[model samples]
Target: MTPRADPLTVEVVELIGTVVARYYEEYEHAAAEHSLTGAQARVLRLLAHEPMPMRRIAASLKCEPSNVTGIVDRLESRGLVERRPDPADRRVKLAAPTEAGRATAQRLRDSLDFAREPLGELSVAERALLKELLQRMLGMTPE
Candidate 1:
């Protein structure tokens, strides 16, 4: 039989879900002003960082390759991103953001300035503590 989560685990999961939902809502609103959906904006942001193979993009987005293809197709249609043959392998396609897409990603990131407000409520010490705790929970490094 499958094991069930304890009450504390369930509560923590619920809290995480709530925070993620709120963050996404804010991002969606900010992104909509630039005529991009949250998923599309996310893809563009990833592309802005570096070119990635379609399979890697799908893995990062936790979606199927087919879904990533559709998202890339829409972005390409908007002239935000383009697909090119990977330099190392002609058979492999890579996604790269255009200048317009990089600009859009920057604008979208600037619009969703959530950290500037509520985070301001915490003192530097408290912010450090919170960051340490959250990083521990996520199995990540604070830096």
Candidate 2:
């Protein structure tokens, strides 16, 4: 049922997978340094941008809402995240990062040596091109 990809396409897919795996590996290591799991750190990072409802977070994380509840519970206990009734819908709860949580997220981003070192090697134009190419590959934006 699957169509074969060209050799170049297959190789590119494999390389992307390898790069993603290594990035996650490095991310987990960085997360451990802060006494957090990758998932916890990820939730913090997401909340650092803006609050999100439990269902939306579950959808984004590709997990069940119950799973997100547990993650939120843990984060809440750590004083990193708080649950408040959604202003848009009183029946729903939103998870938001505290000031401490935002600071931790920033620190985690700052400590990502894996991302900084190699990407820093590229010129600004090269980085822009790479970003454009990756965004295109993911269909994230219009050309």
Candidate 3:
């Protein structure tokens, strides 16, 4: 048996979905300006932090390994990423962003401010409260 959500809960969930979708759309447009697709830009962003295996990237992006291969291939051809054998396991390959990739990723991040502009309208205390509430909703402990 399914339990129905309260009206307030439903409204909240719908608003969250709408906000997330809008953010993605804005991000995609920003990425396009850099000659990268949303998926490719996401891969660059992920690799900007550290090297990761194709499997892990696929898992993070909720896509298949084969799809990741193509994305990685494109990034690599553009000198945006490099693949090297994992230090822990020589058989496993890890992908890391190149210098150009890192620069592009940073640019992409700096260019996207859909949330930043609106969030800036809130006071510091309000922003903090919103962050805390969002963390709680995501089941994350405050640092």
Instruction: Score candidate 1 by TM-score against the native.
Output: 0.82
Error of 3 at 75 (Å): 0.4
Query: How would you encode candidate 1's per-residue C-alpha lDDT over 1-143 as one tens digit per residue?
Result: 22245777777788879878888999989889999988999999899999999899999999999999999999999999999999999999999999999999999988876655777899999999989989988899886
Off by more than 4 A, model 2? 1-4
**Candidate 2 lDDT for residue 56:** 85
Model 2 TM-score, 2 decimals: 0.92
Question: Model 3 off-target regions past 4 Å?
Answer: 1-4
Model-by-model lDDT, in order?
A: 0.90, 0.89, 0.95
Candidate number with greatest lDDT: 3
**What's the CA RMSD of model 2 in angstroms?**
2.3
Between prediction 2 and prediction 3, which has the larger TM-score? Answer: 3
lDDT digits (tens) for residues 50-98 of candidate 2:
9999888888888898988998899899999999989999998899999
User: Sort by lDDT, best first: what order?
Assistant: 3, 1, 2
Q: Residue 59 lDDT in model 1?
A: 98
> Largest TM-score belongs to which candidate?
3
